[model samples]
Target: LHTGCIPPIVHRDIKTTNILLDQNFQAKLADFGLSRSFPTGNETHVSTVVAGTPGYLDPEYYRTNWLTEKSDIYSFGIVLLEIITNQPIIQQSREKPHIVEWVSFMIRKGDIRNIMDPNLHQNYDIGSVWKATEIAMSCVSPSSIGRPNMSRVANDLKECLISENSRTGESRDMESKSMEFSMGIYTEVIPKAR
Candidate 1:
């Protein structure tokens, strides 16, 4: 669901595992039981009990029980990081389980070579890689307002992919086929649940 509706549908649960790939590898959103159509205009946010996957949950929503479209953006950011690192939300190791923290640390340390999937083997465009990582980082901003709207994100990601295609000399057709899937946790967080 690309969210073209009048009142945007907020996917309360967004995780990497929930996205499914079709035979053509196009991403598809699954599990819609938890979606709620967000209110628009002067209403700042919807008050509801916070419900979502642990590592993917938005800190702001968890703290204040304020649900907004930005909450879904936060989870989408985690998924982006997962794609970049080819790592699960929580790793098997005890010292560093959260991929988000690990990636942030690695980027901060300027040790990004290890952050990219080894399968990539430096074949991808460096600029595109950085652009994508930056997008993910932007999505995970602690402040919900700090995150870019979906339109901005879509543009940024499109630019990233286009740049990659140009740099790698990949076919134009391949660029059109790129897709992303979103994981959603099914839950109904009633207003009273707040």
Candidate 2:
């Protein structure tokens, strides 16, 4: 999703383990061995054999063998769910069997607290967590076309980060810069500089 490449690359595999963080806590995508570029000129997807971790693989891509950038988004969503719930991607011992299903069930029952990682100790902004959960669910939509592009996802998350950091006394200037860049994504709920 680094927008630098001439032809956009689809990271066929994106899991929590493959995302590396540096000393500054910046995340970088790794393991490009399964990456593929979108076909040149107006082509939206590339036909290929499905090759990604089982729990994180995009169901549409696995079923159709037509890979798109959305496949990565789906995988990223799975990672986000894992981070939020701190649960295994798939656990046969659980009735839901998959993280998504468990999260969905919780949401249906209006249990946001259960969906959140307890390690957070109720320190984060609830609105920000709600927004992040919404974004993650959107990313995992069953249809590829239903997924937001990575830029949109990044912008939405930037808003969530801004909202959450605003509570911890991060500088207003940092919030301002991020808000300016992502104004359109979450204008309704973006917290004002205090």
Candidate 3:
């Protein structure tokens, strides 16, 4: 579900609505209106017109008009944050700030629990939630260079899922063994004459 080009391509506009989901809940990226192709070579950045959803736009691109693969990465990071927090990118709470701002503040304060959606309480694993949150924050970092590429993000997510699955399996196996032992089903064999 990823495409790479020489010098790489700039998505320009990556947003939630543009990401279509099928009946089976498969994600398909759509709407490439602002997309532009860049030639592959030794170039740090390319200047282009401002084009993209408001909340998902990269500040750096807006300021310098310089586009790069990292612009898409910044947008994708916002999407990931939305997925984890189940909160819209923008909120109209006078007392609270935007989702990104709020998340950044909480992260800076090292208070991840404060940002988690209360609805997920007791339903999701704490470790996995924190790990996902960390990755999302890293993706949206102010410094584009600090952000990971799409491939790395996907790989990290996959690894986290796999680790959680393995932990669940191990827990189940341990429980089953404990039950068998409690039922006296396992017998300790004593060696006979050599």
Candidate 4:
């Protein structure tokens, strides 16, 4: 869900390519051409034509033609998965073509380590990685109602960062600054989507 507003705006398209990172690695979600806002407080969703990247589209929104903040959550979840695994969202030759399906299969096998990017060389904190994986999985839940709002995701990811920092013995000042930028990305950037 979009943050930093009472009536949150829904950015119907959210993907890794659209997420721009400045030199300092501060993230900014760009490309809001498909954004839509709930016209009234009582309305839960905006009925609109489904439009988004194939790999990142929210299945529920595509099926029902009902667009909501949860749709954005699903796309962002895919982004998270991409960040973790460094794998393409869809690989046709793979048995499980979709990234979510592949990740789920790997998780079922208890192979979290393999699911992570090989480039990491298992240098990350397992607890932190697990937490992030859980958050990403929840964001891609089949039911929109089951998915979390953006604030919760931001907070949970911040916890992951803190846990990772604790492992590496990073300074609290660095954590604070990183978290502040991260929070702005999740809370402020998406809401400004037109």
- After superposition on all C-alphas, the RMSD of every candidate to the true structure, in Å, is 9.2, 3.8, 13.1, 6.4
Error of 2 at 94 (Å): 2.1
Worst 10 residues of 2 by lDDT: 178-187
Q: For this target, which candidate reaches the highest lDDT against the unseen true structure?
A: 4
- Where is the poorest 10-residue window by lDDT in model 1? 185-194
Question: Which pairs of residues have clashing backbones in candidate 3?
Answer: 6-40, 7-40
TM-score of every candidate relative to the true structure: 0.84, 0.88, 0.78, 0.88
Error in Å for residue 114 of model 1: 0.7
- What's model 3's TM-score? 0.78
Candidate 3 per-residue lDDT over residues 39-132, each given as its tens digit: 6667778877888989899888888888878888899999988887778898887235567787888777877666777676745556776777
**Residue 140 lDDT, candidate 2, scale 0-100:** 94
The regions of model 2 sitting more than 4 angstroms off are 172-194
lDDT of 4 by residue, 1-194 (tens): 36665567798889989999989888888987888766656788888888999989999999999998899999999999999999999999978999999999998898889999999999999878887998899999999999988877987887778778889998676545556544543433321101
The segments of candidate 1 whose C-alpha lies over 4 angstroms from its true place after superposition are 1-3, 92-95, 173-194
Please state the error at residue 140 of candidate 4 in Å.
0.4
Residue 119's lDDT within candidate 1 is 91
> Per-residue CA lDDT of candidate 1, range 68-178, in tens?
889989999999998998888888683567887788888888766688888988788776787788889889998999997776677677767777878878667633456
Kindly provide the TM-score of model 4 when superposed on the true structure, using C-alpha atoms.
0.88
